[model samples]
Structures are given as C-alpha cells and as structure tokens.
Target: MIYLDANATTAASEEVRRAVLAAMQDGFGNPSSVHIRGTNARQTITNARDEVCLLIRGALPEGVTLTSGGTEANNIVLRGIPEAIIVTTSVEHPSVLRPAEAAAEHRVVPVLVDGRADPQAIAEALPASGDVIVSVQWANSETGVIQPVEDIVTTVRSRRPDVFVHIDAAQAIGRIPVHMDGIDALTFSGHKLHAPQGTGALVLGDPEETRLKAQILGGGQEGGRRSGTQNVPGAVGLGVAFRERAKAFDEATGALRAMRDAFEAAVLSAVPGMRVNGGSSPRVPNTSNILFPGIDAMALVALLDQRDIACSVGAACSSGRPEPSHVLLAMGLSEDDAYSSVRFSFSVMNTMDEALSAADIIAETVGKMR
Candidate 1:
C-alpha cells in the first residue's frame, strides 16, 4: 500500500524499534524503585530526556516532561496554568481546543486564517491583571500550514511579558527546525516523527514560571508534571527517532516537498475545479489539502483505499466523525467545500514514483465519480 497519512501517525523506525526492544527486555525495572535495576531504568529515562532536549536545542533537561502524547501535554498546560487568559487559533487541533473549552474561567482569544494569530488581536484580548497563556500550533496537521510562531512569541513577550506561550509542535518537531529561543513551552508527539505511539514530551523554558499541574495523579513521574510509571521503552525509542531524524531533516523535507508539489500540479491539471487549500501560505513540506468540487471526500477516500493508496479526509483524530472539517471551516470554507477536502501527507519513505502513481489514481477516481 502507498501510505500518505504521516500527519496522522508514522510507522516507527527500525532503529527506534530496536531501542524499544532492548529497553523492554533488559531494562525492565521500575524507575521509581531504589534497586540497581531501577537505577538503570532511571538512567535510561534521563538519557532519553537529554536526547529530546537536544532535538529542540533546549538548554536544560529538567524543563522536558514526557507524556502519553500531544493531547496530554496540551491538557497539562491548559489546566495547569490557573486563571490565565488563553489565546489560540480557530484552526488548532482538538487537543488544544477541548482543554481550553473545559477551562471555563480562562478567556480564549481566537486567531484567524492567513495561518497566524495576530499579535494585535492577542494584545486586545488580554486582561489587565491576570497572567496569559497563549497556545498556538507550529504547523497545522491537515493543511501543513506553518504558523508564524516566532513572531507570535516575540509579540506576546513584548506586549505581555507575563504571558506564557505554549506551542503545539506535534507536527513540526523533527520534520522542521524548532528553535526554542522565544517559546516558553513546546509539545511534540513521538508517533508523528517515526517513533512509537503513546510517547510525547513537553519542553519548558522555565518550569517554575509555568508550573504544570499534574493531569494524571499517581506515582510521581515526569518531575510530577505528569504522574505515572515512566514508559522507559517508549521514551528511549522516541529519543532515538528524534536524534536520527535531526541528522537528515533538510534532505528528507526537500524530497517530501518535491513529491507534494508534483502531485498537486498533476491533480490540478487532471481535474477541473480542484483548489489547493492554504496554497497561498507557507506550509510544511510534506502535506497538501486539495478540494475536488462536487466529490464527497469520504467516498474519495474509500475509492483510493480500494486502490491501496491511504490518505485522509482531515485530521485522523476526527476522521471518524460525519461533520465537516473544523480546520477548513475555520478558514471560511463552505460546508460543501469542507466536505470535499482531501489531505495527502507524505513521509520520508514515499518515493517520487509512488507519489506520481497516487496522483494518477486520484485523478482517475475523481473522473469516474464526476
């Protein structure tokens, strides 16, 4: 099968799998236990933490806290920061939106398309006395649009020095350069970058300043930011994946962009009334969301699946729903346009030939439906 769903999750790399197996078989002791076996597990976790910190060029290991995935990391930030005014874009992942929705006391500032949270909008939304926690994603999952996070961080810090900026970099971390210079905290998922599932991390600039309250209560782990026995195997695997990917990011990204661009051009030429969503903005290298007018996205997805080409209607977390894409809707697409959107996300494993074949199949399927 030709897999095009990297935005949803990626297959774990061989190196990562090896690392996981080694940890599970030999390093089976509980990190919290005081015995030598436990000490070995604790050291493994610490080594993993240092590797993750290096991925983002973070200075200290104490600021990085491992979590189940991006959702938990986002929740910890939203619920942990008390009474802080929350600012985020309308097009954020549900992970960010849902937690903010649950925090009834916090004020939420909505960012617009053009794929940016306007600094002025944030400035206008801030209250006088309370602290602010601005959550914005570095790269959108569906459209691959890259938000101006550096600019947002600069604006928020200059305008409201007390504000803490948390970036959901689940889609950006290993795929692109993540300079943590201005960011207060950043979240990332392992599965998004060829590591095992159920693994992710939150990197903080100042843990004391933006102290995260524990979302899951139990045995103290992750510096008490998240409580549970450490997933030593998963953590080790994630660290290996990130360190390997960081070495070849630029080359892999270039290949992905080339494939995406070629597929998009072919699709536009082969089919009429096909619009590229977020084409005007700066997007990540590996994704393209295309709209095939008069075609049902769900139907198209099934058709492509029959041809052994895997893709998605939108974010995988919400694909099972019947509703139109919230991301497209936030970008002002009509219900029909939103329903017609299909997202194709590439990965390092995909070849240029496979990309061309996928485009041909897509064009053929759309033609038959039309």
Candidate 2:
C-alpha cells in the first residue's frame, strides 16, 4: 500500500517504538506512588517533558502538560478561557473551530484564497477591551499552508500585552521550525510526529498567568492543568520521536518538498484545469491539497482506496461527512470547488518514486472521470 495520509497520522519511528517498550517493561509503576519503581517512572515522565520543552524552546519543564492528543489540548484552552473573547480563523481544524464556536463570545477571521490568515484581519478582529484570546494554527493540516504566527503574536502583544495567544501547532511542530519565544501557549500531538497515538502536550508561557482550569478534574496530575494517571510509555515514546525528528528535520523537509513539487508538476501537466490549492502560500513541505475541477473528491478517494493508495478529502475527523470543506469555504472556494478538493500529505518514509507514481495514478483517474 502507498500511504499518503501523514496529516491524519504517521507510523511511529523505530527509535520511538524502542523507547515505548523500554518504558512499559521497566517503568510500570504509577508516577504518583512513593516506591522506587514509581520514582523511576516519574523521572522518565520528567525527562520526556524536558525533551518536548527543548523542541519548542519553552521556558521551563513545569509549563508542559501532557494530554491525550491535540483535541484535548485545544479543549483545555477553549474552555479554560471562557470569559475572554476568542479571535480565531475559520480555516482551523475542527478541534480548534468547534471549541471557538462553543465559546460565548468569539470572532472567526477569514483566510485569503491562498489559505493564509492575515495578521491585519486578526488585528481588526481584536476586542475593544483587549481582553482576548487569539487562537491560530501554525500550519493548516489539510492544505499545508503556514500561518503568519510570529507577526500576529507580535502585533497582538504590542497592542495588548494582557491578551492570551494560543497556537494549535499539531501539524507544524516536527515539520517546521517552532519558536516559543512570544507564544503564550502551543499544542502538538504525538502521532503527528511519529509517536504513539493518545499522546500530546500543551506548552504554556506562564503557568501562573495563563493557568488553564483543569479540563479533566481528578487525580490532580499535570500540575493541576490536566488530571489522570500519566501515560509514561507514551510520553517517553513521544520524546524519542521528537528528538529523532529534530536531528533530521532540515534534511527530511528538503526531500519532502522536492517530492511534493515533482508530484504537483506531474499532476498539473497531465490534468488540465487542475488547480493546486494554497500553492501560492508558504506551506509545510509535506502536504498538498489539490482541486480536480470536474471530479468529486469522495469518488476519487474511493477509487484511490481501491488501488491501495490511501489519501484523504480533508481533515480525517470530517472525512465521512458528505459536506463541503469548511476550510476551503473560508478561503473563498465555492461549495462545488470545496467538495472537489483532495489532500495528499507526505511523510519521511515516502520516496520520490512513490510520489511520482501516485501523481500518475491520480492524473489517469481524473482523465477517465472527466
């Protein structure tokens, strides 16, 4: 099978798998217990926290709170800051967009056709009182378009120092450069970075000032920000994955970009009227969303699946629903155009040959259908 669904989830790296096994076999005790075994488990968790902190250049270890995944991290931020007005883009993942909708007071900023959030539009959406919480994704998951986060954060801070900024960097962490310098909080998932599923983290700039009210109140783990028995094995695996990716990020990015560009060129050349979504924007090297003008995305997805070439129509969470992509709609795509969009995401394991082959298959299929 040719797997082109990295945006949905990635296969865990060998290094990460080894770390997980080591933790499960030797570090099985509850981290909260007082025994020596427990102490070892607690230390392992701490070391993992340090690795994540290092990845984002966060201030201290205490600011990182491990969660199940990106959804939980987004939920914590959205529910924790209820009183604050939420200013977010409409192109965000459902994890971020759903919570924004539930917030009592919120504003949804529009993204340009290039799939980038405008810093000026975000600035315009800011609340008059300056009591706002701005949430934007570092890179869009489906389109791979990178947002102007640093500019938005800097502009917002200059205008309102007290405003809280939360970034959902689930797709950005391992694929692109992530700096925690001015960011108040950032969220990333383990599976997206080759760690096991059900593992993620939320890094806060000021644990005291931006103290998240416990989304899941119970055993009081994760410094009262999250509660439950910590997943030591999962955390350890995530740390190993992050470290391995960090060591080879630049090389991996370059290779992925070459494959992506080649794939785009092949498809566009063979299939006329085929528009590469978000091609004009600065995107992460691993993802590409394309519009096959006269073909239905769902039908194309089924055809690809039959040939064992796995891809997606949009966000994995919203795949089964028979509806137009909200992200494309936000970027001014017509409902018909949005419904015709398909996303192809790459990973470190994919080769240029595989990408070229996939493009050939896609072009042939589109030709027959059109």
Candidate 3:
C-alpha cells in the first residue's frame, strides 16, 4: 500500500528494528540495579539520552526523560504544572487540550484562519501576576501548519519571562530542525520518526528551574520525574532512528518536500474545487492537508484504501468520529468544508513516483465519485 498517513505513525526502519532486538537480547537488565548487566543497561540508556538530546540542539542530556510516547510526554508538562495558569491554543491535539483544560484555571487561545496561533493572542491570555504555562504544538498533525514557537516564546516572555513555554514537537522533531533555546519543555514521539512505537522523550530546558511535579510515582526512576523500569530496547531503537535521520537530514527533507509538492500540484490540477488547507503557511515538508469541497473526506479515504492507497480524514487518534475536525473548524471552515478535508502525510520511505501515482489515482477516484 502507498502509506501516506505518516503524521499518525511511521514504520520502523530495519536498522532501528535490529537495534531494538539487540538491546532486548543483551541489555535486558534493569537500569536501577547494580549488577554488571544492569550497569551495562544503565549505560545504554545514558547513551540514548545523549543521542536524543543532540537531536534537539542545545538540550541538556540530564533533562531528557524518556516516556511511553508523545501523549505521556505532553502530559508530564501540561498536568505536571498544576500551579500555573495553562494557556494553549484551540487547535492543539487532544493530548495537550484535554489536560490543559482539566486544570483549575486555563485559557484557550484562538488561532488565525491559517491554523496558526497568534503570539499576541497567547501573550494576552496570560495573567499579570501568577505563574503561567504556555503550551503549543510546533507543527499541527492535521494541517502541518507550523506555529511560530520562537516568536510565541519571545512575546510571552516579554510579558513574563518566567512564563513556562512547552512545545509538543511530535510532528516537528526529526522532520524539521528543533532547537531548545527559550523553550522550557519539548516533547517528541519515536513512532513519528521511523522508530518503534511506545518511545518518546520530554526534554526540560532547566529541570531544576521548572521543578515539575512527577506524574507517575514509584521506584524513583527517571531521576524521580517518571517512575518505572526503563524500556531499554525502545530507547536503543529511538536513539538509532534519530542518529540515522541526523546523518541524512538535508537529503531526506529535500526529497520529502519535492514529493509533497509534486503530489499536491498533480492532484490540484486534476481535481476541481481542491485547495491545500494550510498551503500559504510554513509547514513541515512531509504533510499535505487538502480541502475537497462537496466531497466527503471519509468516503475518499475509504475509496483510496480500496485502491491500495492510504490516507486519513484527520488525526488518527480522532478517526471514525462523526463530527468535523476541531483543527479545521478552528481555522474558520464550516462543518461541510471541514468534513470534506483530508490529510496526506509522507515519510522518507515514500518516493516521487508513488506520490504521483497516488495523485493520479486520487484524481480518477474523485472524478468517479463526482
């Protein structure tokens, strides 16, 4: 199948698979133990931490706490700071929105028609006196719209430098360059970057300064930030995946952008009433969310699947719901328009030929439906 739903998840590469297997066989001891095998496993985790920290330039290795995935990593920042007034955008993933709203007092900042949160809006949402946490997604999973994180951080900090800025970089991490400057905490998922599922990290800009409360309590593991027996194999695989991407960053991103642009151009030319959802905005290279007005997105997705092509209506986590996408609605689209949108995300494994073929098939399928 032509898998174009990478924003949901990516298939692990052979190298990452091998790394996980090797770690499972050789580094099977608990990192908390003092035995020789345990010491070796501890060293393995430490090495993985260094690799992950390197991916997010200027990050401190000690501040990187491995988690189950992006959801948990995001929760560690959102729910962990209960004392702060959580300020987040309306278009954020459910992981960030749900926990932030669960707080005693929180503000939901609205986004522009382009699916971008205005930095000024976020700054205005902050109170004048108490501690505040501003959480935002670096790149949206549905539209691939990239938020001006540095600009948002600067605007918020100018109002209140102590305002903690947390970024959900699950869609941005390996696909784009990630820097930790002026960002308090950043979360990324391994499955989004060609690594195995159930692996992710939350890197604190200054763990001591933030002093975030622990969510999962027990064993005093992960420096007491998270308590559990470390998943050594997952960590090893994630490190390997990041290392591989780092080695070929420019080449891979360049190819992905080319493939996406080619596919979008072909589809738009062949299909009428089609437009890119966030075409004018800065976006990650591997995503294309298109609006097909008057057409049901789920119907198109199923028709494409029948033809051995894969795509999605919106976030995989929110699939099968009868309601329209929150992200699209926040962008000012009507219910009918929102229901007619589809997200086609790509990965390094996808090729230019596959993209073009998918475009032709998509145009043909839409024509038949019309």
Task: Say which candidate scores most in TM-score.
Answer: 3
By the lDDT metric, which is better: model 2 or model 3? 3
Tell me the spans in candidate 3 whose CA falls farther than 4 Å from its real position: 315-320
Pick by lDDT: 1 or 2, better one: 2
All models: lDDT? 0.85, 0.87, 0.92
lDDT of 2 by residue, 18-77 (tens): 889988888899999999998998999999888887668654678889999999999998
**Candidate 3: pairs in clash:** none
Best by lDDT: 3
Model 2 global lDDT (CA atoms, 0 to 1): 0.87
On residues 199-286, what C-alpha lDDT tens digit does candidate 3 reach at each position?
A: 9999999867545899999999998999999999999998999899888989989999999999999999999779999899999999
Please identify model 1 stretches exceeding 4 Å from their true place.
Answer: 106-113, 315-321
- Candidate 3 backbone clash number: 0
lDDT by residue for model 1 over 1-370, one digit each (tens)? 9999999999998899999999999999999999999999999998988888766865467888988899988888888876666777788899998887777555555546555567677666666667667888899998988988777777777777877788999998876788678778889899988989999988888766535567788877877778889999999998898888878878888998999999999999989889999888889899899989889999999999999999999644445567888889888888899999999999888999999999999999999998
Error of 1 at 163 (Å): 0.5
Displacement of the residue 265 alpha carbon in candidate 1, Å: 1.7
Better of 1 and 3 by TM-score: 3
